[model samples]
Target: MLSIRNLHASVDGTPILRGIDLEVKAGEVHAIMGPNGSGKSTFANVLAGREQCRVTQGEVHFQGHDLLAMSPEDRARAGVFLAFQYPVEIPGVSNIYFLKAALNAIRKYHGLEELDAMDFISRVKSKVEMVKMDEALIYRAVNEGFSGGEKKRNEILQMMVLEPALAILDETDSGLDIDALKTVADGVNQLRSDDRAFIVVTHYQRLLNYILPDHVHVLSNGRIVKSGGPELALELEERGYVWLNELTAGAA
Candidate 1:
C-alpha cells in the first residue's frame, strides 16, 4: 500500500532521514524500533506530510500516486492517518464537530455527499462505542484538559473513525499506562483488516506485546539496520540496543 525509495528528509534545513527504503503492503503491521535521535519520528512526520519536514531526496508512493507531491489534506483524503504521540488540545470545539468536519472533508474529496447530522451522529456513536470511549467525552472539546491516556485514546478514536488505509502510529504507546496501552491497542486492533496497513513506531517492546506487529525493523542513525519478525523485538528488549550498535559498527 505504501512504498519508499531512498527517502531522505530534513526539518528546518537540518537533515534527519537518510535514504530510507521500505515497503508496506496491505493488511500488514510493521514496527519500527529505534533509540533516541535515530530519525524514526522524522520518517513518520515525512509520511504524514507534516509542513515543517521537507523531502530532500527520493520518492514516496502511496497506492500508485506520488505522496510527496500531494498536500497534507490530500494525503488524508487518500487514506493516510497518523496517530500522534502528543495530541494537542483544541478548546471550545466539540470533538464530535471536529470529527464531522474531518469526515465530511474526505467525503467531499471523493465526490461523495456529506452525511447529514443524524447519519454522522449514528456512525460516530457506533464507532465511539466500539472503542469504548465515553459518550460525554465526545461532547467535550478535543483533548482539552485530557490526561495522557485520554489523549492517546482520542488519537486511536480518530483512527477508527477515519478508517485510513495506512496508519502511522508514532509512539502511540508512549506515556500511556498499561491499561491505557491495552485500550489504545484494542482500538487499533479493531480497525485492522485485509485492506488496512500500519506502522507502529516505538522505542519499547511492551507495546508490541499487545499489537503484535507482523514485522519488526530496527532503525538506527537514520536508516533501518535490521528487519526481522516479532521475536526480534524481544531480543532487542532483552539485549538492549548495544548489540545492534556493535553490529552496525562492525558492518562499517
Candidate 2:
C-alpha cells in the first residue's frame, strides 16, 4: 500500500534520514527498530508530512498517488494514520467532538455525507468498546489528565475509530506498562485486515511479542541496514543494536 524510494529527510537543515527504501504491501505489518538518533521517528514524521521534517530527495507513493506532494491533512483524509509517541492534550476539545470533526472531514474528502449525531455516537461507542476504553474518558478533553498508559490507549482509540488503510505507530509501547501494552496491542490486532497495513516503529522487541510483524527491519544511520523475518526481532532482543552497528560499519 505504501512504497518509499531512496527517502532522505532533514530537520532544520540537519539530515536525519539518509536513504530509506521500503515497500509495505496490504495485509502486512513491518516493524522498524533502531537505537537513539537512528531516524526512526524522523522517517515516520516525513511520511505523515510533518512540516518540521523536510524531504530533500526520494519519493513516496501511497495507493498510486504522490504521497509527499500532499499536505498533512490530505494524508490523513487519504487514510494515513500516525500514532504519536507523545499524544498532546487539548484541554477544551472533548474527545468525542474532536473525533467527530476528524471523521466527518475524512468522509467529506471522499464525497460522503457526514454521520448524524446518533450514528456517530454509535460508531464511536462500538470502537470504544472494541478498544476497551472508558465511556467517561471519551467525554473528557483529548488526553487531558490521562496517564501515560491512558494516552497510549487514547491513541489506539483514535486508530480504531479512523480505521486507516495504513497505520504508522511511533513507539506506541513507550511509557506503557506490560498490561497497558498488551491492551494496546490487542486493539491493533483486532484492527488488522487483508487490506490494511502497519508500520510499527519501536526501539525494543517487547512490543513485537504482541504485534507479530510480518517483517522486521533494522534502521541505522538513517537507513535500513538489515531486513529479516519475525526471528530478527528476537535476535535483536538477544544481541541488541551494537552488533548490528558493528556489522553496518564493517559493510561501509
Candidate 3:
C-alpha cells in the first residue's frame, strides 16, 4: 500500500533521515526498531507529511499517488493515519465532537454521507468497548488530563473508528503497563485485515509479542540498516542495538 525509496528528510536544515527505503503491502505489519536519535519518529512524521520534517529528496508513493506532495490533511483523507508518540491535548474540544468531525470529514472526502449523531455515538461507543475505555471519557476534552494509558487507548480508539488503510504508530507502547500494552495491541490486532497495513515504530520488542509484525527493521543514524522476519525482533531484544553499530558504520 505504501512504497518509499531513498527517502531523505531534514528538520531545521539538519539532516535526520539520511536514506531510507521500505515497502508496506496490504495485510502486513512492519515494525521499525531503533535506538534513540535514530530518526524512527522522524521517519513516521515524514510519512504523515509533517511540514517541519522536510523531505529534501526521494519519493514516497501511497496507493500509487505521490505521498510527499499531498498536504497533511489530504494524507488523512487518503487513508493515512499517524498515532503520535506524544498525543496533544485540545483542552476545549470534547472528544466525541472532535472524533465525529474527523470521521465525517474523511467520509465526505470519499463521497460517503456523514453519520447521524446517534449512529456516530453508537459506533464510537462500540470501539470504546473494544479498547476497554470508559464511555464517559469520550465526552471529555480530547486527551485532556488523561492518564498515559488512557491517552494511548484513545489513540487506538481513533484508529478503530477511522479504519485507515495505512496506520503509522510512533511509539504507541512507550509508557504502558503490561495490561494496557496488551489492550492497545489487541485493539490494533483486531483492526488487521487483507486491505490494511501497519507501520509500528517502537523502541522495545515486547509490543511485538502481541502485535506480531511480518517484518522487523532496524534504523540507525537515520537509515534502515537491517531488516528481517519476526525473529529479527527477538534477536534485537536479546542482543540490543549495540551489536548493530558495525552495520550502521558500514552503511555510512
Candidate 4:
C-alpha cells in the first residue's frame, strides 16, 4: 500500500534517513526494528509529513500516488494514519468531540455524509468495544487524565474509527503493560484485511509475538540495513545490532 525508494530526509541540517527503501503491499504487516539513534522514528515522522523533516531525496508513494505532495491533513484524509509514540493531551477537547470532528472531516473528503449524533455515538461505541475500553473515557478531554493504557487504547480507537488504508504505528508498545499490549495488539490484528496494510515501528520483538508481521526490517544510521521474515527479530534478540552494523559496514 506504501512504496518508498531511496528515501533520504534531514532535520536541523542533519540527515536522519539515508538511502532508505521499503515497500509494504496490501494485506501485509511490516515491522521496522532499530536501536536508539537508528532513524526509525525519523522515518515515521517523515511519512506523517512533519514539516521539519525535509525530504532531501527519494519519494514516498501511497498506493502509487505522490504522498509527499499532499498536505498533512490531505494525506490523512487519503487514508494514512500514524499512531504516535506519545499521544498529546488535547486539553478542553472531549475525546468524543475530537473523534466526531475527525470522522466527519474524513467523511466529507470521501464524499460521504457526516454521521448524526446518534449514529456517531453508536458507531464509536462499537469501535470502543473492539479495544475493550470504557466508554466513560470518551466524554473526558482527549488524553487528559488518561492512564498510559488509556492513551494507547485511544490511539487504537482512532485507528478503528478512521479505518485508514495504511496505518503507521510508531513505538506503540513502548509504555504498555502486558495486558494493555495484548489489547492493543488484538485491536491492530483485527484491523488486518485484504485491503489494508501496517508498518509497525518498534524496538522489541515481544510486540511482534502478537502482531506477526509479514516482514521485518532493521534500520540503522538512516538506512534499512537488513530485511527478513519474523525470524530476523529472533536474530536481533540473540545477537543484538552489533553484528548487523558489521554487515552494513562491510557492505559500505
Q: Which candidate is the best by lDDT?
A: 3
Candidates ranked by lDDT, best first?
Answer: 3, 2, 4, 1
Off by over 4 Å in 1: none
On the 0 to 100 scale, the lDDT of residue 54 in model 3 is 92
lDDT of 2 by residue, 1-252 (tens): 999999999999999999899999999999999998999999998999999999999999999989999999999999999999989999999999999999999999999999999999998998788776788999999999988888888899899888899999999998788988998899889989999999999999999999999999999989899999999999999998999878679656
Residues 206-237 of candidate 3 have per-residue lDDT tens digits of 99999999999999999999999999999999
Rank the models by TM-score, top first: 3, 2, 4, 1
lDDT of each: 0.90, 0.93, 0.95, 0.92
Candidate 1 positional error at 85, Å = 1.0
Clashes of each: 0, 0, 0, 0
RMSD of each: 1.3, 1.0, 0.7, 1.0
Per-residue lDDT of candidate 4, residues 1-252 (tens digit)? 888999999999998988998889999999999998989888998998889989999988997779999888988898999998989999999999999999898999999999999999998999999898899999999999899889999999999999999999999999899988998899889999999999999998889999999999999888888899999998998888888878779656
Model 2, 191: alpha-carbon shift in Å? Answer: 1.1
Find the candidate with the highest TM-score and give its number: 3
Which residues of candidate 3, in runs, are more than 4 Å off? none
**Candidate 3: residue 237 lDDT (0-100):** 98
Candidate 3: C-alpha RMSD to true structure equals: 0.7
Point out the worst 10-residue segment of candidate 1 by lDDT: 243-252
Residue pairs with colliding backbones in model 2 are: none
